[model samples]
Target: MAQVYLSLGSNIDRERHIRAGLDALAREFGNLSVSRVFESEAVGFDGDNFYNLVVGLHTDLPVGQLAARLREIEDANGRVRGGAKFSARTLDIDVLTYDDLVGEFDGVKLPRGEIVKNAFVLQPLAELAPQHRHPLTGKTFAKMWDDYDKDRQKLWPVHFPWP
Candidate 1:
């Protein structure tokens, strides 16, 4: 089984949308490890602040199949296409990485350059995979996450019992 990490976010009905999305992902994947939800301002979007977190999933699904599943989970949560860049979303799921198997599709690369760029992703990811090393840069998730800049944005830990 490939250990996959995904970033999940929702600005519309923030918590509810996220909860629903989590439920959907759980139903589909079975084994899900969710990160503490972090509330942060919309980075590029201009609608509402979002509740974001990273989820670690263990599955045997291929990268393409996993991506399709992630997109479907987001779509089921009210995400609309063709909107402005970084628009507030009901559910946004991005495949951060698939167990170091890096490849490109639709012009985007797995572990996509954003893995090291966004704290919303790295923080929770570090929590999930402290010892897990990156495929390209070879840095452990915890190290990269701890080293990222968290200047203006704040990450509030979600303390609920995990799903």
Candidate 2:
């Protein structure tokens, strides 16, 4: 089995979608290593704030299959596709890293570029897997978070209960 990290977020019906997403992930992947949920303003487009968090799991499924499964989970949770690149979402889950593999696999980029670009993705990731290195940058998530510009974006930890 390979260790995988995923970033999950939602702006529409944030709490319900976030919890539903976690439920689906846990049901499919067993126990998960979860990070504190954070609330952040939408990036790239004007929209409502989002609830975001990171989750770690181990799976034997290949990258392509795993990505497809995640999409199904999102679809079941009301995710809409073919919208603008940046828009409101009911559930958005991204594959961040797949056992240190880099580049695109099955059309999904490992160690997602958003890790370095968005505080919402990096903050929870650093909290969950501080020691894990970025597959391409070789920098630990903790260090990346420390180096990140706090003012570039604003996000704060929120009271989120997940089972």
Candidate 3:
């Protein structure tokens, strides 16, 4: 089984969508290593705050298939496609990394670029897999987070209940 990390977020009906997303993921993947949910201001567009978290799972599915399954979960939870890239979302689940695989594989980039650019993605990811190195940078997620400018993007942990 390959280890995979995914980032999940929701703004519209935030709590409900995030919970639903997690439920779907756990059901499909059997078990999940979840991070504490963080509430952060929406980036790139004016919108409500988003609940973001990272989840680690083991799966034998290929990269493309795993991405497709995630998309199905989002769509089931009311995610709309063809919208502005950074607009509000009902649910957004992205493949952050597939094992230590690097570069574009099966059309999805591994060690997602957002891992370095967004506090919402990096903070929770670091909390979940602190020692997992970035496939390309070879830096631990915890180290990346420690060096991150927290002031650049505001985020805080929130109470979240899950199975």
Residues 31-138, candidate 2, lDDT per residue (tens digit)? 999999999999999999999999999999999999999999999988999999999999999999999998889999777899999999999999999999998889
The TM-score values for the models, in the order shown, are 0.91, 0.98, 0.98
- Candidate 2 regions exceeding 4 Å error are none
lDDT of 1 by residue, 46-134 (tens): 56777888888888877877888878887878789997877878889888888787778554478766777777778888888889998
Q: Residue 17 CA error for candidate 2 (Å)? A: 0.6
List where candidate 3 sits over 4 angstroms from the true fold. none
lDDT of each: 0.81, 0.95, 0.95
Q: What TM-score does structure 1 among the candidates reach?
A: 0.91
True-structure RMSD, every candidate: 1.7, 0.6, 0.6
RMSD of candidate 1 to the true fold?
1.7
- Best of the two (1, 3) by lDDT: 3
Candidate 1: segments with Cα more than 4 A from true spot = 105-108, 159-162
Top-lDDT structure, candidate number: 3
Candidate 1: Cα lDDT at 77: 80
* Per-residue lDDT over 33-86 for candidate 3, one digit per residue giving the tens place of the 0 to 100 score: 999999999999999999999999999999999999999999999989997998
Residue 150 lDDT (model 3): 89
